[model samples]
Target: MDNFAHLFQGFAIAFTPVNLLTALVGAFMGIVVGAMPGIGSLAGCSLLLPLTFHMDPTAGIIMLAGVYYGNMYGGAFSAILLNIPGDAPAVMTAIDGYAMTKRRKAGKALFAANLASFIGGTIGILILTGLAPTLAALGLKFGPAEMVSLLLLAFTSIGWMMGDDPKYGLISTFLGAMLALIGMDPVNGQIRFTGGNINLYSGLTFIPIVIGMFGFSQVIEMVTNRMSFHFLGGEKLSIKGSLLNREEVKGILPNALRSGVLGCFVGILPGAGATIASFISYMTGKRVSKKGEQFGEGVVEGIACSEAANNAAAAGAFAPLLSLGLPGSGTAAVLLGGLMMWGLQPGPRLFTEQADFCWSLIASMYIGNIICILIAIAVIPFLTKILKVPAGIMAPIIMTLCVVGSYAANNNIFDVYVMIAAGFIGYFLNKNKYPIAPLLLAFVLTGTLEKNFSQAFKINGGSPSIFFTKPISLGLLIFMVLFITVPMVMKKVKASKNTGDQPG
Candidate 1:
């Protein structure tokens, strides 16, 4: 009842003229950014984060949240129209969405994506509204040792669960940790790994790295690959043609509902992100649907499951960000930085201290969700036109944005160079099949982990046994170990079974 009352208050705040306009603008820009390939929510938020400095914190964050929600809706546009994913989460959408395009059902795919995104985002926000405060209360019980263990578990999950190979993910995770270690030690206050360079003392700026890796890396790929697209039919993209029939609506409802529920829980997990949620939801749909065999064969269900899950996951990620100061996804990590920059400390205390801000943000999500769907549906005709833009033209525009966004972060020329270097590194890393997500996640979390580990050691007179003595910490450690080991063991068993089946 208290939550409901607070939510009503929040709605009042969100409905204020300035906040509402910000939300609308944010949604529009987010759709444009997400419709462009390679510039995901991470880069989009980073690019626009500088603009937030001029506005009220509430309005600024409202805009970013709008962008986050809008991006989830917009990503499906490119995947359906051009067969290229606008972001990582949309990759699953392309598998089925593009197949629909090939069959001259692009408009239907766009409509299904928009509908599923709305359902999933609504479910996620509802769950988040109910769960975040409870989770924050629960988080208050965690001690330093427990925090350390939990952080370790998050790191382990990122390394062990993401991408095709755990080895590559782990390597990426370690690289991020190594980069994070270059600045002064947080506990000791002693300079380390700076190599006497003045710029290194303050640590690397996150926005530049993020913009380079996600934004500039894509530019590099576009220049090198020079990919082209071909649309099947012009009439198929009309808004009238995009409307779903009764049977189609029924088909999407169950899949979207189920995936929305599943994705929300997945998003709450410390390191499980929208990409993972989408993949898991799509796979679940494949296994459960009656027409499972036709999953990748231009099926509406496939698009619904993938789009719904990713959007749900995007909303669910806020639970940890607000309640525990832990980022639930890559974009959430960027938002975590924004929270700090806004002079608001995230975690359990934030609920009690910043109730107005918290509830208003939640309320705005509902508004943003509605705004995104309406805009997505209304702009469907124009969005298909975006697909006609050539990669050669798009690459230069994104590259210019990347350069400007990076430089604008601190007004530093040096950061521009750093962005370029990171872009090259990211491009090579992707070319080598290494996942960049774990790297960025590790970079974000490593400092927090170190702080908790230091606090635990100080409390226990430098004895590591503090981690084992606490039940929660011990359980978390055990879970991390099992999480890493079980996958390897299963893979080995499967390989052995396959080998045994082959004739000697």
Candidate 2:
């Protein structure tokens, strides 16, 4: 009852005209930034981080939260329309989303993505509201050893789940780990692979690398392949036609709900971000759905699971941020910096000392979530028009956006060069049919894995027994082992049975 009363007070604060306007503007800008390939929530929020400095801390945070939510909703746009992920989390969405686009179901795909995003965001927020303190406490139990085990499990599962030939996935995984190791060592602060160039000291920036790989590489393919510029059967695009039938809505609800719950849990875990959540949920949907075998061949369930998990993870991330002062993802890290800038110290003290501020931020999320969906739905008709642009015109436009987004990350000319090089590398890799997901997964998790492994070793005085002794770490290791071996064993058993059935 007290919580409800406080929430009502929060609603009162959030209903203010200034706060409402800020949320609207933030959501709009986030959608725009996220829709543009290569400019993800991290870059979008970083660019806008300065704007919040001049406003009230509560209102400012509300706006940034709006952006965070809106970005999750918008990231699917490019993935569905252009077959290029606007951000890392949208990578899984592109597989089926682009398939849907090719089938002239872009409007339906967009609607489903938005609907699932809303459901997931709502679930995450509700969980955060009721269990922020408890979830934070649970997360605090994940020490260095546990984190290392969990990340290893993530890497192994990602590699195993990606491609038909597991070898390709493993190769991509190793390559990503190698690329991640090029920068400075987290434990020793010593550089490893930075040759002679000073720019190499900081290693590579993610934004430039991603823009080059996904965005620029795509531009290369467009020009080289001379692909058709316009989408087929886009003659009568309208809002009414985009509405999901009752059956489609029913199909999305269960997947979205399941993914929402799963995403919240993943989001609470340290270093497991929305990208991983989306991947895991999409894979889970594949295993459970009756049409699992048709996942990448244009399935609404795939979009529902991926988009829901990512958005839910985005909202669930706030639990750790507010209660434990920990950032759940890269974008959350930026938000952490903002929290400090606002003269607020997160943790138990925050809820006690700044209850109004915290509650107001929570209240604003509900409004922002609604505003984002409504805004996104309204813009669908406009966004779908991107499919009608000519190839020649779209090609140059995407290239320019790629360059601008990469340069904007750090205002560095060197990043542009890196982007171009990565583009060529990505193009070559794609030509060879290499699975990119494992490489990306390894690249993101390797650094975190290294840091935790170092920390665990330091804590245990170089004894490897620490990992085995910790209950959580041991459990995760067991799970990882089972996850790897069980499938292979089952495949062998099935193969033997088929061989025995052959006529003599």
Candidate 3:
């Protein structure tokens, strides 16, 4: 009853004219950012971090949160119309969405995506409201040993989920972990990898690294290739039917709900984001749907599965951040960093210490999604035409934002150089097919992981078995082992079967 009362109070706060206006503006900006290929929510939020310095913490957080989930809805636009994913999470959406576009059912694709995204976002918010506090209660039981085990689990999960070869994932994680160790030691005041540079003492800036990799690198790639986008036969956008007929809606609702649930669970795990959730949900939908074979060729359920799961995962990624002060994805890490910038530490205490702010933020998500859905539907005609913006015209804009965002992050010229260096290196890494997720995710977790590891050792008086002795830690360790090992085992089995079939 008290919780319900607090929730009502949250609604009161969210419904205020000032807050309502902020939500609308944030949603609009997020949609624009998400629809642009290079400026994902990560870069978008990073670039906008400076804006929060001037506003109330609650209002600032509410706006940023709106941008976070709003991107999920907006990303499907580019995926469907251009076959170019606006962000990593939209990659799966393009598989079916673009196919629908090619077949001239672009309106139906947009309709399916909009409905799925809305359902997923709304359900995810409800689930978060009911489950976050419980998860926070569970997180309270974790000590240093458990935390170390949890980090290990995150590493294993990302490594196994990334691609066909887990080696690339492992390599990416190692590289990130190593980069994370460049700053002063967390336990002691001594710096380990600074190489005598004064700037290194503060460590590599997150904003520059991400801007270089996702923002600058992409623009460089497009310019180098002289990329050009053209619709088939120069066909203009057209849709003949209503947005969603009764039959299509009935066919999609169940799968959208199922994918949302699946995505929420995946999101709760540290580092598993929309990309992984959408792929997993799409595969699951393929296995169960009667029109499974038709999935990649304009199937409505494919759009539902991908869009719903990704949107749900976006909301789900907030759980660990809010409840445990742990980020589940790269964008969440940025948001977590933003929280720190405001002189507010993230963790369970936030719920009690800033109940009004927390609850209002939660309530605003409901409002934001409704706003995002309305805009997404109303702008389909214009949205579909965004692909017409030539790469030549877009390149300079992306480059400018990347540089400006990097400079503003630290107000340092050296960081701009670092961004340029990172961009070139990122391009090289991309050519080699290295997965970037593990690196970014690992970097975000490294400091905390190291801190917990050292603390656990001290608490156990150097007894390593302390990790295995704790029930939760032991279970997490076992899970990590299995997760890392199963892929290798499966590969071996497949190789053996292929060899046996070759000549015998």
Candidate 4:
């Protein structure tokens, strides 16, 4: 009952003239950014993070969250139109969406994507509204030991995300931790790895590194590779209808709802993000649909599965961050960093201490997603036009943005150089199939992980046994061990199977 009242008040806050305008503008920009290949929500939010410095924190976060959700909606555009996903999460969408486009029902495919996005997004936010508060309330019971264990669980779980090789993920995670250790030690107040450089005291800025990696790295790759695109239909990619028919809607709504639930569940997990959720949903949709055989053949059910699941996952990824100070995904790690920059700490205290801000942010999500659906439909012509914009033009623009964003954060020329260095490192790391997500997220969460670890140790008189003594911390540590070890065991078993099958 109290939560509902708070939500209503949050609606009032979100609808305030300035906040509403900000949401609308951010939503529009986010979609445009996301429609650009390789620039996912992280790139968009990181690039724009500095702009939030001058605004109120609540409004700033609201706008960024809007961008976060809008990107998910926008990613489907290129997937359907150009057979190229704007971001990884949309790769599944491309499977059936592009097929539909090839079948000359691009309009229907576009409509289904947008509709699924709206449904999934709405469900996600609603789930957030319901789950966040409960989790926040429960988080009130946590001690420092539990906090440390929880963060450890988050780190270890997310570390296995590197495709096919968990060791690569672990290496990336350690690098992030090492980077996070570069600044002054929080407990000792002594610089650990600054090498006497004055600029290293405050630590490496998260935004510049993120922008350089996700934004500049891609631009560099494109420019170097001189990437080119060839649209099947050229500049005249046209569609027949903009709105979904009743029968199509009926067929997909149930699946959309099911995917929404699945996506939200996946999102609630520490590192299971949109890509995993979308693939899982697509597979599930294929298994049960009467038109299962036609899934990859332009079926609307396929679009519904992918779009709904990913969008819902995007929304679902917020729960842990808002409630427990633990990020839900790689992008959520960036969002968590942004919150820290604004002097806000995510946790149970956040909801109680800043009810207006948190609730309003949640309220704004509904509005933002509604706006995204409209933009997805009404802007199809304009968006498809964006698909024609070549990589040559885009590369320079994104590179420029990365440079400016890097220099703008602290007005330090050194940061720009740092960004360039990070860009090179990131490019090489990515080229070698190392997962950047664990590194980025590890960097973001490492500071808190250390802080909680130190505090928990002190409280226990420097005895690490407290971690195992407490039930919450013990369970969390056990989970972390399982998460890290199970994958290695599975990989070994698979390798042995393959070796046995090989000829001498």
Indicate whether candidate 1 or candidate 2 has the larger TM-score. Answer: 2
List residue ranges in candidate 3 displaced over 4 A: 1-22, 29-120, 161-164, 227-362, 377-384, 498-503
**In model 1, which regions exceed 4 Å deviation?**
1-120, 161-164, 227-364, 499-504
Estimate the overall C-alpha local distance difference test score of candidate 3.
0.77
Could you give candidate 4's per-residue lDDT for residues 1-504 as a string of tens digits? 677788899999999999998898889888887776556777778888787888898889888888888888888886687544566677668768867765656777888999999999899888888887564344444677877786676566556544347688789978988898888887778888998898999788765676566656656676676633333334444444456789999878988998988887667766557765776677567656777667767889989988999999988878878878877677889889988988899987888998898889889999999888877788876655644566567566667766775676567888888878888888899799886656766776677678878988998899999999999889979977876677579879999999999998
The best candidate by lDDT is: 2
Model 4 bad stretches (over 4 Å): 1-121, 128-133, 227-365, 380-384, 491-504
- Cα-based lDDT at residue 503, candidate 3: 86
Question: lDDT ranking from best to worst?
Answer: 2, 1, 4, 3
Candidate 4 is scored at a TM of: 0.62
What ranking emerges by TM-score with the best candidate at the front? 2, 3, 1, 4
Compose the digit string of candidate 3's lDDT tens values, residues 1-504: 666677778889999998998888888888887876546778778877787778777778878888887788878886786554566677667768877876767778888999999998877787788787675455456788987897777666765555447687788878878988997988887888888998889888765776676667767777676633233334355444527788889867987998998887666666557766776677567656766557766788988988888888888877788878988788899888878878778787887888898788888888999999988888886665544456666577667767776776677887888889878887888788776656766776788788888989999998999899999999989977876687579879999999999985
Q: List the global CA lDDT of all models.
A: 0.80, 0.85, 0.77, 0.77
Instruction: Please write out the lDDT profile of model 2 over residues 53-163, one tens digit for every residue.
Output: 999999899889988888888889988877667788888888788788878889899999999999999998888888888987888899999999988887887777766
Clashing pairs in 2: none
Which one is best on TM-score? 2
Instruction: In candidate 4, list every pair of residues with a backbone clash.
Output: none
**What TM-score does structure 1 among the candidates reach?**
0.67
Residue 111 miss distance in model 2 (angstroms):
1.6
